[model samples]
Target: MTAAAALIEAARALDALGFMPSKSGNLSVRTGRGYLITPAALPYAETTAADLVEVDLGGAVLAGHRRPSSEWRMHAAIYAARPEAGAVVHTHSPCATALACARQGLPPFHYMIAVGGGGDIRCSGYATFGTEALAEACVAALEGRRAALLANHGAVAIGRTLAGARTLAMEVENLARQYLALRAAGLAPVLLDEAELAAVFEQFDGYGRLG
Candidate 1:
């Protein structure tokens, strides 16, 4: 599919998953010239491919009439910091965003943690949107993982494709939901031990072979 088609497809999928509630999320994919991203303040369910705004790697708009999402600074920072990233997805999924606002990083509570690079996802310190501080914090938190949460904001996921990023975002939220449910049941989460986590990281290349 074309880059534009991919952006719209991702937006719709995230909307269906209830990840993009009421213009609360942003999605973007890398393109040959730069990136095409969702416009700010628009509901994801109503967004068409034509609503996408084109911006260069430096976060300067190259084309399109609409304003880029205010979070484009964070997206641009991720692309700059991690060349492997082909897409970035930010969502305000309930449980995950709640954890973020609580200023807590996810613990290694399940094997699904492996999906985010075999450890707990990190939560960056809070920063104002569209600020350099916010972009820098996001980049720092996402160092070796496919995803991270922004304190008091939402979660961000990056991957080599838009599908992969979207999948990671969904998985992160699912994990958070499970964690919250388990807690509500008065059961302490059985976090994976550091040794086991290290082993998973070491064998991650083999795990990647499954696909």
Candidate 2:
């Protein structure tokens, strides 16, 4: 599928999953000149490929009638910083956003935490949304990681493909939900240590490779 179509498909799926409540999220795919991102203020269920906006790394709109997502700067910053990231998925999924609202990061409570490329998912320091400061904070928190929680905001995940990013975003929510449940039960969940996580990383080297 085309990047724009894939983006819309992911957005709608996330929307149905209630991740993009009240239209509070964005998705993007890197292009030759820059990236194509969801347009601002549009409901995912009603969004179309034609509504996707193409903007350069410098944030110039190359094509599209509508304005780009307000968080486009964040997406642009990520692409400029992480060359390997082909797509970005940002969401306000409840459980994760709840943790973000508390300014909490997800510790390595589950082995799956390693899916983010680290022992834990850091929460970026608080910042006003759609600003460069927010982008910078997110980039810093995502150092050596594929996902992060935006303090008092939401969460973001990046990957080499749109499907990969979308899946990681969902995983973030699932992890957050489980972590919160553990906390609610007054259970101090056992966290995976660096050594254990290292083993996980090694095992994950070709985890899904069939060939």
Candidate 3:
């Protein structure tokens, strides 16, 4: 699929999965020079490929009819910091958002935690959404990871493609549910240690990822 078409489909898929409520998330893909991102405040169900906006690293809107996502700063800063991040997904996914509201980071309680390029998914310090400060906090928290939770906000995931990013976002929400389940059962999570996690990472590297 074309980049614009793929992006639009990804957004709608996330929305169908209930990650987005009242248009509370955004998706973007790197465009060599800048990036193509979802428009701000538009319901994903109502968005079309033509609605996606392209923006520069310097915050200029290069193309599209609707305004770029307010969190374009987060997308631009992440692209600037990690050249390998070809796509980014941000969502107010329910389970993940609940954890983020509590300022909780996802630790290595499960092997899937390593899927995010780290032993844990850090929760960034709270900041108002859409501002440079929020972007700075996100960049800092995601320094060595592919995903993070924005405190009192939601979750973010980056990957080499939009599908991969979307999958990572889904995994984050799944893990969040697992974590909450453990806590609800009055059981403390027994996290995998660094050595074990490193081995898992090696295994992942050796196996070609499907998504």
Candidate 4:
């Protein structure tokens, strides 16, 4: 399917999964000289391909009638920083958001944490949403990683495609849920060592069908 179609599908899927509740999250895809992103404040159930907005990496609107997602700056910054990134998915997934609210970054407690492109998932320092400050913070947090929690905000996942980004978003939430459960049980999860994570990252690089 086309990137636009995939973007819409991702929005619907994440919404159905209760990740973008109340329209609090956003999705975007890199396009010609710019990117197409979901409209601000639009419910995914009611959104269509035509409703997506296009903006240059500099945050200027390039096409479409609707305004881009409030977090467009964050998406734009990511694309500018990571050439391999083709899509970005930001969601207020419950468990992930809860972890972010506590300003907690995910440690490499599970080997699967390597899926996020690093030994751990980082959390950005607190910054108000929709501002360039938040974008800057997110970019720093996402350095050498594909996913991060927005402090007191939500989570951001980047990938080579919308599907990949969506998958990482869900993975982040899943890890968060598991981590939270451990913490609730008064367990400080034992993290995997760096050598193991290095091995996992090498495995991941060659393990995927699409890779």
Q: Candidate order by lDDT, highest to lowest?
A: 3, 2, 4, 1
The lDDT of each candidate is 0.86, 0.93, 0.94, 0.91
* Superposed model 1: Cα runs more than 4 Å off: 202-204, 209-211
Better of 3 and 4 by TM-score: 3
Candidate 3 per-residue C-alpha lDDT over 40-118 given as tens digits, one digit per residue, 9 for 90 to 100? 9899888988899999999998999899999999999999999999999999999999999999999999989988888
The local distance difference test score of model 2 is 0.93
lDDT of 4 by residue, 36-117 (tens): 9999999999998899899999989998899899999999999999999999999999999999999989999997888888
lDDT winner between candidates 1 and 4? 4
Model 2, 1-211: lDDT tens digits are 8778889999999999999999899999999999999999999989998889999999999999999999999999999999999999999999999999999999999989888988899999999999999999999999999999999999999999998999999999999999999999999999888899888888887795100
- TM-score of candidate 4 to 2 decimals: 0.96
Where's the lowest-lDDT run of ten residues in candidate 4?
Answer: 202-211
lDDT for 16 (candidate 3): 93
- Candidate 3 least-lDDT 10 residues: 202-211
TM-scores for every candidate against the unseen true structure: 0.93, 0.97, 0.97, 0.96
Q: Model 1, 57-140: lDDT tens per residue?
A: 887899888999998888888888988899999998999998999988889988678778647899999998778899999999
Better of 1 and 3 by lDDT: 3
Q: TM-score: which is higher, 2 or 4?
A: 2
RMSD versus native structure for model 2: 1.7
